[model samples]
Target: MSGKDTGHGTQRLALPGVFTAEQAAVTAAAIAGIQRADGAIPWFRGHHLDPWDHIEAAMALDAAGDHRRAAAAYHWLARHQLPDGSWYAAYADGDATRPTDRGKETNFCAYVAAGVLHHYLATGDEEFRERMWPVVYAAVEFVLELQREGGEIGWRRDPDGSACDGALLTGCSSIHQALRCALALAELRDDPQPDWELATGRLGHALRHHPECFLDKSSYSMDWYYPVLAGALRGAAGRARIEDRWPEFVVEGLGVRCVSTNPWVTGGESAELALALWAVGDSERAARVLRWIGHLRAPDGLYWTGYVYADEAIWPRERTAWTAGSVLLAVAALTGDEATGAVFGGAGLPRGLEAEECCDRS
Candidate 1:
């Protein structure tokens, strides 16, 4: 398309009521501006880096054709990966070599696969893919080590290396998608990982049939929509999941609430839910979700994290790289960006294993 949105032969991510080409580039530029020299994108300059959100910002860079910056971000991950194939939970933005938090989150560990796959799809960088395959493979193995007998991943590996008790619905759902992305990488390398396939099926089964097992976070909007967004629930099941929680989480002229309890609606959750809605074939509502969050976009092209409608204020008072990244990605999806659509829409993503094929027998 137009401007810097050339990665993957994608059309300019201009939605009718959402973003024009130049405006979309502005948003991408905002994220690029905040990125550090080492390619780490913290929540804001002062905030610490977390692996999952960091990868999300990197993917957004690739979407906008800032491929070099995106490559540097991935390389940062490679340099910092721990011996166990996991990254420490938080790295100080000022000095990434210093970890502020040492706990390794399972979902955070798994998401490198999704980011690697998305970047490769966008740029078709064979060298990058080759470099990243082992990183993804090791990360997947590390995450699977925490997979419970019931197929849900444990929340995190503590600094002492013990598995933390309990599975998170949102986190596991994200991991479900990551496992599939990892499988795609494995397949491309001509090395099939049947264990990952089985793990994917079991995890999907747990999400679809055994929701009671995950930590009860039903009050959060991410718990409501992440399964669909991550492709763990699809078809009629996915559509029904969206409808069931729509009234509780959606603010009419604003965006999706961060949690059901607050009047606070967040850009990241709202855009992710839009991607989820698009996956479920609800394009009309999906587009509306993006348009509703227009108020959150600042004059500088960065989006505020969330708004407090009850007080009519932008709470937390930060315009974050991840929020802008989520907005860019959702816009790209709605406007027919091929790479964005393929990754989130499950077009070219490898279908791991059917639930019946793997889980029923277990």
Candidate 2:
């Protein structure tokens, strides 16, 4: 299948075996409808925006060939950056918005690197990359400021600017991917951030070998699968990790559970798990995982956040742009989009700084 023209001034890319062209167009339109005039995409039409999810939605726009809107989303983030290069945890939904949450999360701050690089990769937009460099740089700096001696990153900073002491395995894993993307962006710009390289190496090391350094959120599916998705573990180790926890988190025909104990299967996690599976060369399983979430798709092509098996209903009753964003990302990865493939499959992203003394000196 080929790309199709959407009325929304974008071409919807088709991903056979994952999503049909019509489905992709519908999803793209759904995302477009929820995007604010300023290009910020909220969780839903009337919800708040978080940096991580906002970037996910923006990348979806890029995947759908809505470059202008994607660029607008990046600009929104750039415009709202704090002096320390971080954003408030959440913002109110609309034009007359205020910060709904004031805490700044390290992973959320760092994810702009991945988003900016994803946009650059998809569009090959040097000018856009140049424009976003400082935004990515400052955000990465803010995140690394929280890195500890043990290599795990502190999770969040309160509104008062005090850092939290603990870290999350999933969050650090996600940040590891962002660090790699940051390095890739630096490479594109003929800039070298040696400190970022070292930080990436240490962060990857902590994620792969030092679970003791992060908070125990083992019951969550993200903590189980994120290392693979983030490229911190690859090949045999990545395969083993996913297999080890498969029965615990996956719900077969339903989808991946948000948490092991919950009777809930979420669209976002399931789609991400599909991407993680694709990262490890398990395309068969990835396809299956993506297909399983078809149950969550609404008539308008937006996806319900999750299904509560206990109640047999959509748990949150909200159709989120990010959830649709995840589906588009997974589709892009599976359908051989080079940029999305690289970001998710570790094709050309930085391998993180090595832990040797030579790396530190360099």
lDDT of 1 by residue, 337-359 (tens): 67778778886777677778753
Q: Which residue segments of model 1 deviate by more than 4 Å?
A: 1-11, 359-362
- Give the Cα lDDT of each candidate: 0.87, 0.87
Q: Report clash pairs, candidate 2.
A: none
Once fitted onto the true fold, the runs of candidate 2 whose alpha carbons sit more than 4 angstroms away are 1-17, 94-97, 357-362
Error of 2 at 324 (Å): 0.4
Cα lDDT, model 2, residue 148: 97
TM-score of 2: 0.95
| lDDT (Cα) of model 1 | 0.87
